[model samples]
Target: MSIRISAVAAEYGRGLRRSLDQVIGQIDEAKRTGVDLLVLPEACLGGYLADLSDADSTLVHDDPGPPELSVAGPELAELAAAAGELVVCLGFCEIADGRRFNSAVCFSGEGVHGVYRKVHQPLAEDSYYSAGSGFAAFDTPVGRLGMLICYDKAFPEAARALALDGAQVIVCMSAWPTSRTGAAANLADDRWTKRFNLFDAARALENQVVLASANQAGRFGTLRFVANAKVVGPGGDVLASTGVDAGAATVDVDVPSELAQARRFMCHLADRRPDTYYPPHSMLSVS
Candidate 1:
């Protein structure tokens, strides 16, 4: 009942093809190391930028076409093929029916398995991206794998939804931006000034499940996404983490027993009172 997880912090703001190659390399490396799962930075395919003014204008879509039925779409095949024996989770901009959404697509030897559109689009994101309506979890060989994007991790309900849905592994793809003054750049200690944030710990503590986060590295124009990729176990302990620059980390997780034990102790899922809980604002009132 072990889950071998890996997180790849790729160089931020690189071309789609080059970044895909790096991600493939990470997948291959994970395969060689017996890692069962691999996660990469957010927007790994489309590049982590609000707009692709810098990239060839032809690729940038003012009006994105229809959303591909699956990750097997022309743009995502190579990545899906490179997933090999491990499950790969990576992010990309979704072009669906003349609308665009920030999406993360999961690929495995079986092909596209899960897709999650980012729910909590941040302030700047509101201008360029549309918010996703809900959250979901999917079944996998390792366990129930949940999908979440960058800003979605900030919301407690996002993880709760997954946990309630019986997800054992919470996978997050983010491209968090840093300050411009470079104050975050010279942070020396983990106390007051830290490179990595606290979302991973919070999410793990709340859900009591393995939390894996992959973030981009380097500055995307004015945005600075200092790579901080890591994997947190069911007990909210960080198994492996990465620092600045493009790098990768891996960890083996004993998911089944850990999840069972955590649930047995806390028992959040068992104690849920779904029948009694009701929202005041409802389209259809339940009597």
Candidate 2:
């Protein structure tokens, strides 16, 4: 069966209400296009904060992080209602047990399906929120789904773990920005943008899974986002993309068939050499 999926590369401002309005509008647009699944950028609800300039300075209090929200809060409930039959995946600042997490949630009319906390904290992001312990895949209306938040996509093991857990489609939501230290004049020319695109293709090809990436666009605080949201087929082909602008990359594909075909020749998952290789910690211990 074919499913219509859309990955949104759009600006999410600081206000939560405004963000919800934007999400509602996107859902309406996706509905018109018969989109079965919609994926929005990381920190799409509360908006991401400025880059961490000081890794060790506790006195740096000028920029507070995004607002902490509960998974069962009214905001997510509203989004779930707006989603209706359409499956929606978006990132948020999750608050639970008085702790905040850089988290992503997937929901539909039936309510929340899955939630993922970002495991890999780049820069000083760990100062703001707690890191997730592991990666997991959950069942959704479209297919077996896995979610990654921002820097989590940088680590190969994260996607590999999810794929091993039976994820057919991996949705990576990012609040990625251009080079912070020496940014290029044009956003498209930025090196980080290239890495973002390369990672998407590599993860999909390696895992033989459909990969959908949604990223923040426009400027927020000191960061200038690179909105290169796209969907990649199992063979690492760019199915649809929003380039470097604020828009949605939509595509229709038969998920199972595409995965089967990609793995038909060489199943990377089936071909294992885990015992022959050294442990990740042991390898890190070497250098």
Candidate 3:
């Protein structure tokens, strides 16, 4: 009952055609490798912000931000066609009702399974993109899947909500960069990269669910991305990883069986005392 899953670390840019060509090739390769699900880096459809030097600059990059596309756009349809039997999750900038948000969509040949707007924005990201409000899981061919974009994974409640709603596999897409002020000499030693990896492992361990973490790699604008895509087992163990380089990592996992085993002795989710917990949404932004 094990399903093969792959998480990718690669560079994508402003050229829509190039991105599609690369992704389609990846999808075709995954099909050959028997991958049931494929996770792509954030903004793979277009690209991520090039610079964040001035926090309140109100600029996505030196150029225009990645094309604002709708979920119903033809590009996604093209991707869906290529997906065929493989369920794929990837990110992009979404334009809805004249406002733009960071979004991810999961789909297969059957059609779109789910869409998740990133609920958490880091630094001055909110100045460029509007925030999403919630998290939910949806049925997919591989299993019940939940998706998060970039900073969303940094919040425990974001993944926990999906886990509670029956997500067996969680896919997180990011264009995460190295430290803004003080970066490590090596990409591997970068503090931001460590936090990114830690969040992927901790979220899976706490939720008792398998996790596929995909991230952008190489340099984009003024940012140097930390490419460390990986597949983590329910016990927080990284089964496969691309390290700090641009590559894809794959692993076979019997999600349900592993989830059962992880929760067999200590059921973290079931043992929760909601009555004793503080309200999650009580805090408001100071600015």
Candidate 4:
């Protein structure tokens, strides 16, 4: 049950053709290295927001924002074909039911396995894209997989839901940027960078599920990204990481064995007492 996972951190901007080329290149490398599952940053298919300064403003910003793409579009088809046997998870601005969603889609050469629209919207992100409804895990060649977008990982309930749904691994795609104010001179010293890394470990440790985190690198518009992609073990251990640079955190881990070892005695999910939870969403159910 050993799986090879690659958490990718790279630059993706407004050019659709360039973005596709960048992702395809990574896929080519992963294929050569025998990666079973590859997770790319949020909005890697198009790009992320130009700036967070006016997200809270009701006034429509002049910037057009990330180009919206359908889950059934040709871009995804092209990625699927390039994926061949590899399971690839990537983010995009999804247009569905007349609303745009910050979404992630999982697919392979065979076809799509599942899709996740980010349920939690941060800051003024809600002003642009409508939030997703819930969290769910789907079966894949790698294992039972759950997906979360950028800010969704900030909420413990999101990851917990997928764990309860039998997810062995969680793919968290993000376009997280450096601090807007009191900006740190170094990327690694940035407080937001620490939180980005902390959330990845915390979610994995608490849920006893392997976590694969990917993020955008470089800068786009008024945002400068913190490219700290990583793969974390169920025990809160950093198995591999790309630091604050643009690259992939690649690792070979035995999923079931790690989960079993970590949960040998203090199984977080099994030990939960849902009955004691508060009335409103303390113990929510996807059913």
Going through the candidates in the order shown, the clash numbers are: 5, 0, 0, 0
Q: Report clash pairs, candidate 3.
A: none
**TM-score versus the correct structure, for each prediction:** 0.83, 0.94, 0.94, 0.94
lDDT (Cα) of model 2:
0.91
C-alpha RMSD between model 3 and the true structure: 4.5
Regarding lDDT, does 2 or 4 come out ahead? 4
Better of 3 and 4 by lDDT: 4
Cα distance off (Å), candidate 2, residue 178 = 0.4
Give the worst 10-residue stretch by lDDT in candidate 3.
53-62
Q: With candidate 1 superimposed using the best TM-score fit, by how many Å does residue 201's alpha carbon deviate from the native?
A: 0.7
Q: What is the C-alpha lDDT of each candidate?
A: 0.73, 0.91, 0.91, 0.92
lDDT for each residue of candidate 1 in 83-131, tens digit (9 for 90 to 100): 7668888888786765668888887877787888898876556555667
Using lDDT, give the best candidate's number: 4
lDDT of 2 by residue, 1-287 (tens): 99999999998877888988989999989998899999999999969876655653334546556878999999999988988999999999999888889999999999999999999988877887888899999999998999999888889999999999999999999999998778888888899999999999999999999999999999887678999999999999999999999999999999999999999979999996887665543444553
Compose the digit string of candidate 3's lDDT tens values, residues 1-287. Answer: 99999999999987878988999998999999999999998888878876766664435444776788899999899999999999999998899999988899999999899998889988877877889999999999899999999888889999999999999999999999999978998999999999999999999999999999999999878889999999999999999999999988998999999999999999999999987677654656798
For candidate 3, report its TM-score: 0.94
Determine which window of 10 residues in candidate 1 has minimal summed lDDT. 187-196
Q: How close to the true structure is residue 79 of candidate 4, measured as C-alpha lDDT?
A: 92
Off by over 4 Å in 2: 55-64, 280-287
Total backbone collisions, model 4: 0
